[model samples]
Target: MLKPYQVYNTHSLSLCYNDYLLLQLLLCFWSSLFSLCLSLARNTKKILYLLQVAHKNSSMAKSICFCLQKLVFFILLSAIVSHARPPQVLPRQEPSYLKFVFNATDLPSEDYYDYIVVGGGTAGCPLAASLSHTFRVLLLERGGIAYGKANLMTQDGFLSTLVEVNAFDSPAQAFTSEDGVPNARGRVLGGSSAINAGFYSRADMDFYKNSGINWDLKLVNESYDWVERAIVFRPELKNWQSAVRDGLLEAGVDPYNGFSLDHIPGTKIGGSTFDSFGRRHSAADLLLYARAANIRVGVYASVERVLLASTTPFSGSRQSAIGVVFRDSNGRYHHAMVRRHGEVILSAGAIGSPQLLLLSGVGPRPQLSAWGIPVARHSPYVGQFLYDNPRNGISIVPSIPLEHSLIQVVGITEDGAYIEAASNIIPFASPARSVFIHTPSSPLYLTVATLMEKIVGPVSSGSLRLGSLDVRVNPIIRFNYFNNPVDVRRCVNGTRKLAGVLRSRSMEDFKFRDWFGNRDFRFVGPALPVNQTDEDQMADFCRRTVSTIWHYHGGCVVGKVVDGDFMVMGMNGLRVVDGSVFGVSPGTNPQATLMMMGRYVGMKIIRDRLRYS
Candidate 1:
């Protein structure tokens, strides 16, 4: 008989050899299949005809093809499972423009600039960067910097960053809508862009044609290119994302557009702000393009209100925004005034812009009086027309381990609904850890993947009002989700489509087989209704599960609060140039267009100034 240790070593070696051989075979098969696919891609019609004929004949060739396809998929799945976890330690680097950024506490009691841009978030960063090329600008942010924060800088930490909220000074600020749905907003320098899923897509053509602002198409494209060159990257699709893409096609989302940055009707892979090494690049990076000497960025600078003065001595004369009063982190107040012919711009997002305007006494006269605020301008529409796209979806735990992924592939349906997916690892308490015990138990986590849908251009809307005298407090708002019949119908259709995706052949491996041999998905939360055709049940599901995708907009909208030029109505030296001016949300994700708008408006301002000078 062989010795016990010798027997164990022999068995381990034998298994290792078998695994090595299998890996080599898989790699060879995958390489050959990839080349074949590339050739077929050049002539799609021929490939489709071949597939059709094979299906009709049901011959040996069809069987061989099916086996080969399954083998390739298995190989890809194995690779994904082997490397599902991301690296724990990544190299973090600070941007060169940090030299130009300073803490608000260090600023003088009073300062002057050619332009004062409030809220150094998504739009404000690019806007300040663009203006710095030709004019002096001051970009003030109410939050701290995003760089050097690991949670905000890595793809694996996306969810963790959003949940780390506090009463003050957290990267994310939490709030609940009057509709009873919980939500969070970015309180960092990059705004939502720093904390979002990193999906980057341009606005739809209809957005440009319908928006009240007169856009220069050439300049728009140029601005997009500028942003893309700095941050956007083509994502590497893994098994979960690849399966979702195939499932979308199988469910008839149709005409796979492949990898693209444009918003088109089909299943496509969109650009991401996270690079290949899993590091994120947010809108704050846009400042690298700015002329550092001409721009000053102050973090932890919260503007209390716009300083408005009557342009003429007579009463009823138009009031102009001459400056702003802001408080630093140390509680010291400072005045940032604009020079002659200078402007004060508000890029303070949809929520912040309107709330600031209301606090400055620019809303309805009666409402302001009730709040004990003197009316600076009687702009009745300052806090009206608030909207947030309602997101509803289902989450499931896969039978096989899956990698963590953010929004990468998007399925754009022709019926005005967009579908997306994300997989995340969440830590939860184990049963062994008692609530009263001070000692912690071993760490346990659950991997949950989601398939979600949101309707395009929701017709239902609501309003916002003041909640507190403190500027840091969240405002009272409600986005009456699914109030319109049209939105409800769209949600019903979208949910049914998700049901189809769950049933697709591409999703078969992810399902769990019960003792009776019935394969079904193990849902993490609520599952889709069995009778998808029941519109009432589907609509009820939508209403109950409705949540915000954080794509809210429209308070200081165009034609009501601001004009086509983005200037505040009946107010001189003031302009609102962020999502607040958007009458409708653009494309699937608004960060791409929001950043583009910042650059676009900045260029327009420069051109107008130069021409008149």
Candidate 2:
């Protein structure tokens, strides 16, 4: 694939750096000239004339000596420029495949690495990548390579098939308890981060600051930047629209005016634009860079419990976590012992992490008792506050076309995330932001919108329980979403606003209603926001219809269930470092927050490990 300039430079190997640089420049000019002439279909006569004109200029009284000096200079320049680039190394056997047979006994193999980070998806990937440099770290994942699979993880900015491929496909098929919350967790290598709509944003700073860590926006300022640097995640609403922006301004709900390229739903209500063509990347791509540097990763192994050296006392109820015991696909159980000199971090996501804790005998009494599981250490808070950001799709068959194209465009404002499609609206949000709105076009498609308010209050609490080692029972979720009269009122108002937008757009005026029209969401429900009094109607819509955006957080929290530093409050050597410790839902997407917590906890655990090392 070498260009003409590169070929010319390759021949100029005897020149100094400066001379070589100059040689390459001239060669580039000549190559460009030749290409331009060829592209223009210039004849041999025209090409000859062009060269003659240049030759005449360089001749300078037909002086051969001057021409020789110019030719030498060009060769020297080429040599230097070509040498400046790094030499491409040819392929060879990868170093990571080596088996260092030094651990005499089966003491977990001198794979007795300093750090063994489980789950290289999302938070785990970046955390492992960053820490691998400081120590011999092993990242364990359970999915395939994220990208390069056109069918599964495409490079184009589109939702990958990974999300749809969960442990269970349907709500009925998925395990559930009395609550009936279908567990739709991504079991892919990238985890949920691979299949999501590339939405990104921060939660309310005050929430994190108020949590037991005493972290305020100002104190965690560097933490935010650190996250951005580590990964390219940005706000969900990275950009905004003129109508949306002006509308928000008129409504006195403006945040800042910076814009972005993708559209994460429920990102505005006064802030920047959303990501338009969503960001879709596999965690494997990020970690592969580290893998090139001696880091190791394992896939397809189900981590069962953390292994601690205390038969006299179960580890969960007392000190910190040491290591882990996992069962491979072959049903063989193996333990990675961190008896000392290191640390074990639990990046087993919100849904998985809490379930892991409960299995390790560290949760509430009633739930564990029901499962015939003995409580190693009774921590009333374990798996007590299960939470997830709910989702609902409002569709309007658009008058215009709906092309699920990559390289998308989005607009932001004081409202939430907005897609440009005519009929369908996909927004990711929670009741916490209390944001809603509606903007309609010639609705062959629909233009659903939002203006959210802070929704996740403390009054609504839930619990996560284990049905078996492989299954998490129906999580006892009690969001009390409609409990807030104000929230209900906002939903009603949002509906009204949507109606208004639909009324004003071309579809109505142009009589495109036959295709774009929608039957208003009025049904048999108590919680319907009819004067915010009909709680039944709204509750019906909330219950039967809404799906989770998968932003689960705070079930196995640090302060309530876990400890101040993320160690399961009563557990020894075990720490949960995923999106399950939000203390309170931040009313935004939890991917960025999950990553932050992962990196934060990963480093902290490593710091402690080094302290002991």
Candidate 3:
């Protein structure tokens, strides 16, 4: 056991490390500024000396030299003060609950808890925290904590973190769907919330009405309020985001909704997890509310499978989950068992929860037989009905430079399309090297500003299957984009809405003049079809440019894999309480809803336990 003083020392060291990095950045900035100043001083001195030498007693020359020297000095002073301002220091205080978090390798071979919550992600963290209020809880995260990582903590590092891949420890895990579109999943403590664009919006009323879960409307609102109070913030709009908002309104997107967290049909500036100072507040931060004494967070603890034993009279047919076997970072395994009447919850998002169920022999019987794994329960829909909202849009290079921004303004069209905008500065390899070679040492970069639209409640769906026996390997996921005609029509309508926005008068300043003096938007990728009225052309564009907005859900869905209470059907002591239960992606972004589900379900579980006891 660590002494209290020793724990304090450790936390102090972590804070110091962050301060050290900040100091280094400041030093580098000052050094560059000093070098430039020295060079400018030398040039000014030479100029003044030459002027004096050319006109030995000319007062005009002296006056010119004086003015030049003053001008140069003023410019240098301004540059130093304006450009060399130190970066905003991140919040120094670590969460008090972090004291309960431990490296998985440091844990014993076996442990017992009232609840074992897998995946310390957007949903899992809050779920585990809420559970901790009334019961001993264990939260297991496959990846390390995001607390001190500057890249995951700040808005400026959003795109950079998403683009970082090809490493086992990279926060964003890259995967290409069978549809051949590139996508990413968060591998860090906060899951996708840590690596996402940080947009926050509540689910639409239709979501709750369609969600099958028996929700207490008052509690639902309260749960959303709980999450909002902790993490959500009102974003200050910049040039690009403001223009998108105006253009959306000009294109008939509605009566402006202004700033709101509610999901309403109109152009509105929604909440963000990125605060005014640009630091991100992910779902992992919700752990701060946990009862530290009751909650234990184990990082780098990858759950291999849920352990099951016969529940019937030695029949070995009917089984229930009693514990889980997880592998530590060092490849050593540990067991976490639930105590009497305790449960094991899978809050591992849409992909992970289903994948885990299959791995634990709870999937289709034939699939388990092929893998030589014993079938604990036959769940046909464990990995079925996978859906990813296909994001189709156009990226354009603005005529005037725009400040970097993520999704702030959203246009909810009555035609079942949601439009959003982001301006990102993406790094690229120099021309001499392959574009695939993305290294921090590479100096080249490109500013990609985009207007994207995603359809609401896409009817198209597919499935997820094991790609490899290894849990670390990404599964074979095929979302079957635009598989349904309804989805295609929605996409076409959304694309048409985007075209309308581009044609709006508000976008005129962003358009560039061509060689023939015809002003047009300079497209970074494929431009919108010339004939927006052509449904066939618009449909083709939607199919061709279909990409993931990372709003994928389903698999282990309610009423099929799990019941309305979120417990796995035909199984006891096992429940899935994540985005997997979402029949349709909620609102504009699912992060807010996913986070709310964690708190909501956890509170429900506590209430049920109290009533039964």
> What lDDT does each candidate get?
0.83, 0.46, 0.82
Off by over 4 Å in 1: 1-89, 314-316, 429-443
Report clashes for each candidate as comma-separated counts: 0, 91, 0
Error of 1 at 566 (Å): 0.7
Q: Which candidate, 2 or 3, would have the higher lDDT against the true structure?
A: 3
The candidate that wins on TM-score is 1
Clashes of 3: 0
The CA lDDT at 610 in model 1 is 97
Model 3: worst 10 consecutive residues (lDDT sum): 9-18
Q: List the residue pairs that clash in candidate 1.
A: none
lDDT of 2: 0.46
Total backbone clashes of candidate 1, pairs 3 or more residues apart or in separate chains: 0
Summarize candidate 2's per-residue lDDT along 1-613 as a digit string, tens digits: 1111000112111111212333354346446544644654756675456566767676443454443344443343333222222112222222221221111122232346666676666678767766776777766654434333332332121222422333532111133334454444555555666655444555555457566664434424444455555345333321223333344434333343344322233213221111222224444334543543545566555677665445335433355556677655555666665534556777767667777777766677777778777676677776766665444324322222222322122223223322221111222222243122122311111122222222233234566666566632334444433344544444444443333333332223212221123323211112224443355665455445544445566777767776677666655556666777766665455666665555566556556667976
Error of 1 at 471 (Å): 0.7
Task: Compute the lDDT for candidate 3.
Answer: 0.82
Candidate 1 vs candidate 2, TM-score winner: 1
Report residue 35 deviation for candidate 2 (angstroms): 60
Clashing pairs in 3: none
Better of 2 and 3 by TM-score: 3
